[model samples]
Target: MSKTHEVVIVGAGFSGMAAAIKLKEAGIDDFVILERKDEVGGVWRDNTYPGVAVDVPSFTYSYAFEPNPSWSRTFAPGNELLDYAKHCSDKYDLRRHLRFHSDVRTARFDESEHLWVLELASGDRVSGRYLISAHGPLVTPQKPSIPGLDDFQGHVIYTMEWDHEHSLDGKRVAVIGTGASGLQVIPAIAPEVGTLTVFQRTPIWVLPKVNPPINRFASGLLAHVPGAAAAARLSTSAATEALLLSFIYNKQVPFAVKSIEQLCRAHLRSQVPDPEVRRKLTPTYGFGCKRPSFSNSYFPTFLRDNVELVTDGIERITPTGIRTVDGVEREIDTLVLATGFKVLDVPYDLHGVDGETLLELWARDRKQSYQGVTVHGFPNLFLSPGAFGLAGPSLFATFDLCHGHALRVIKESRRRGATRVEVSQVAQEHWMEKMRARVGHTIFNNPSCAGSNSYYVDEHGDSAVLRPTSTVNAWLAQHRFPFNAYRFEEPSAPAVSARRRATRAAR
Candidate 1:
C-alpha cells in the first residue's frame, strides 16, 4: 500500500504555499507539498537576469496575510522577492511539509481505491485523496523554432534559465523577442556589452515605471505603524485596477484607451528623442491587445549608439549570427532568447477517472474551465487558476481567489461526509457559456487583438490567458458561487469511520 496524504499539492510556489498555509490554519495538517526544484520561489528563483524586478508594485504584489516591511524599492528585485518567499515558508513552518526534489511524473486516478496514484521521478509511489495543481503557467520555457539554432557557436541562454557563469562584458550580444523580459534585460546589459542587437517580432507598449526607493523611514513606518503597509497596498492595487479597466472593459471607449496611449507615447517621446526610432518602437496594436511592460530605461537603451533594433523576421540563425528576412545578417558573440514561456501549454500529463487524459479533454473542450479552478470530468482534483485565461493584473489576487474557491469545495466535501467531489457537467457548461459571453465582449476578441500574436489567445482564436472579468468580480464570484454545482459522495463504511477519526483529530 502506498502512503496516502489527505491532500497532495504539486509545486511549492506562492499558490502551493498559500494553499498549505490555509489548510494548516483550518486545522488540517495531513497534506504534503511536492516541489520538483530544490528550493521555493518559483519564477523569482528561476529568472535571475540582469534587471529582474516585478512590474507590479511591491506592496500589492505581496500577500495581505504576510506583509514585508523591508522592500528596498516599490518594484522589488528578484532576489528580494525570493527572500520574501523563504521568509514566508519559515514563518509559517511550511518547510516541514515540503518534499524537495520530488518531481511527479504521473498522477492517475485509481477508481477502486478512490485515490490518485502518483509516480515520482525516483519511482516512488504515493496516493492522495485530493490533488491540487499549483504549478503555474510560466514553468515551461518556450524556445523559438528557428532553423540552425543549434549551429550557433556562441553561448546561448534563455532568460528563464539564465546562464550566470558566462559573463557578457564587452561581448557582442543579440537578444530575441522584445517582450517583458527583453525590455528589462536590454537596459541592464547595454552598458556592459560591446554591442547589443534586439530582434523585434512585435513591438510592445511600455509605461513609465514608478520605481522609487523605499527608504529607512518608510520601512520603519510600515513595520511599526499599523495600517501603513495596508494603505500602501490598497493604493497600489487601485492603480493596477485602474489600468486593467481599459484593457478588459473600456476598449471600445477611445477616450478611456487614448488616455493610457498618450501616457505611453509621452514616455517614449521623453526617452528616445529620435522620431524614426520612436516610430519603430511604437506598437500598432490597441493599448490592451497585448501584455504591456513598464520600464524607465528600455526606451533610453535603444538611443545608445552601441544598440541596434532589428524589425525584420528571422529567417534562420547562422554559426556566427542571425539572418533576417531582408537578407541582412548581424554578427553576434552571444545569443540570449528572451522569448516568453509556454503559458497555455500543460507541462505534464494528468489522468482522471476512467483513464481519461486531461490534455485530450482540454484540447477537445477548447481548454475551458469553471472560474479557472474546477473541471467537469475530473473529480477530487483542483487546478489553481485553471489553464484558461484566469490571470489578472494582480497575480496574488487571482491565485487567492482560486485557492479560496478550491478550499471551500474541499471543506464542504468533508462537512457533507463525502470523500469525492466533482463539478457537474451542467454547471461546467453553464460557466463556459458565461465565460464565452463575457470574453466575446472584451478587447481580447476585438479585431485589433486578432493579429497581435499574444500568448493569451488559443489556436481557436479565443482568449485563453485572462479571465474576461475584473479581479474584484472574480473574488466575489468565487466567494458566492453555489457549492451544490458539484456532486459529493460518501466513502465506504470503514473509510467513513477512519475519516471521522481524522476529522475529529483535526478539530
Candidate 2:
C-alpha cells in the first residue's frame, strides 16, 4: 500500500516550489512535490529560445520574501530565471520533498478514503489527504495545425522546445506567429539568419523595452540598503497595477488605452522609415485585447535587408517552404513556430467527486472556481491560477496570492481536524457570477477584440483569463473570505473510535 502523505503537489515549477515553501512555513512537512520532468524549473527549463528574457521588470518578478539583489538586467535573461528557481529550491531545501520524473497521469479523489489518489505514468500510485495542482497555464506548447506542416523537409523548431544544437547561421529561416515569443525570437535571430521571413496572422501591440544592466553600484545598493529592494518592487508593482487597470477598465479609463496606443504608434513610426511596413506592423484591434510585448529591436529587425514580413495568409507549408494565399511560395531552410501555449484549458485529467473530470466539467459548462483556488466537487484540491484566478500581470505576484489562499484554507482544515474540505457550490457560483459581471466591462468583450484572436477569450466567448479585479482587492479577499463558504468534513465516528482504541492500547 502506498503511504498517504498529508499533501500532494503536482509540478516542481516555481509555483510548486512556492507551495512547498508555504506548507513548510505553516509547519506542515508531510507533503511531496511530483515533477514530470527531471529538473525543477518548469517553463523556464523548457523554453530556451534565442533572445528569451522576461518582459516584466526583474525587481517585481521575484518573490517578495526572497528578493534577489544580483539581477544582471532589469529584464533578466531566461537562464537567470532558471537559476533563480534553482536558488529558491536549494535555499528552501525543497529537494528532499521532490520526486522528479514522476508524471501524474490522473488524479482521482477517493471519497470513501477521503484522499486524492494520483496515478503516475510509471504505474505508481501516490495518495494524499490534500492535492494542490501547480501545473501552470503555459505547460503545453501549441503547435499550429497548418496543413502540410509535417511534410516540411527542412529543420523545424518550436519556440518552447528550442533546439540549440541546430545552427541557424546563414540559413533561410521562416517564423510563424508574431506573438510574444515571436517578438523576442525575431530580433535575436534576424541578424544571424541569411534571410528571414515572418508570417503574421495578427499584429501585436509592441512597447519600447527599457531593459538596462544593473550596474555594480545599483546592485550593491539593492543588496546593502535597508529598503532599496522593497521600494523598487513597490514602484514596479504600482506601474504594473496601473497597466493592468488600463486593460481591465479600458471603458472607464479610455485615456490610458489611448495614451498606450499613441505611444506604440509613435514608437513604430520612429523605428520603421517605410510607412507601408509600419502600416503592416500596426494592430487594428484595441491595445489591451491581446497580450502585448516590449521590444527595442523587433521593429528595427524588419528594416534589415535580409528580413521580410509576410502579411498574406499561409495556405500551406510545402516540402521546401511555406505557400501563401497570394500564390507566393518562399523557400526556407528552417521553420520556427513561435506560436504560444495552451492556456486556461486543463492539460491533464483530474477526476473529482462522482468520477467527473475537471476538463469535462469545465467543457460542459465553463471554467470557474471559488477565489480561483477551490472548486465545488473537488475536495481538498487547490489549483494555482485556476479559471479567472489570475489577479495581476506579474506571475510571481499571482503565485503569492493564489498559494497564499490555498495555504490559509489548508491551515484552517488542519485547525478543525477536517479530513475533507470542499467549497460550497453556492459559494463557487456566487464567485463566478461576480467574475462574469466584472469581465463584462473589460476590453476583452469589446467589438474591436473580435478579430484579435486573443486567448483571454475562451471557446464559450467569455473572458475567463483574468480575475477582473484589482490586485489589491484580490489580495484582501484572499485573507478576508468567510470560512463558511467551504464545507469541512471530519472522519466518521467509527474511524475516530478505532483510532482512540489504538491509542489506548499503545499507551
Q: List ranges where model 2 is wrong by over 4 Å.
A: 494-507
Top of the candidates by lDDT: 2
Which candidate ranks first by TM-score, i.e. highest?
2
Q: Give the total clashing residue pairs for model 1.
A: 4
RMSD of every candidate to native, in Å, equals: 3.0, 2.0
Instruction: For residues 1-507, write the lDDT of model 1, one tens digit per residue.
Output: 356999999988888898898889888899999888999898888889999998889898889999999999999998999999999999999999999998888888765556887888888877888998888778889889999999999999999899999999999999998888998998999999999999998899899998989999999999999999899999998988878867678545557777898999999989988898998899888777888979998999898999998888999999999999999999999999999988845566788675767778877767877778888778888887785536555788877887888889989989997888889989888988888777776777677775577888777776767887888788788889898899998777876677689779979
Q: Rate the local accuracy (lDDT) of all candidates.
A: 0.85, 0.91
Which ten-residue region of model 2 has the weakest summed lDDT?
340-349
Total clashing pairs for each candidate: 4, 0
lDDT of 2 by residue, 1-507 (tens): 367899999998988998999999989999999999998989899989999998888888888899999899989999999999999999999999999999999999987668899999999999999999999889887889999999999999999989999999999999998999999999999989999999999999999888889999999999999999999899888887888999888778878988999999999999999999999999999998999988989999999999999999999999999999999999999999999987865567899897889988988988889998889999999998899888875988788888999988888988999999999999999999999988877889678787998888888888888889899899999989999999999988887787589779979
lDDT value for model 2:
0.91
TM-score of 1: 0.95
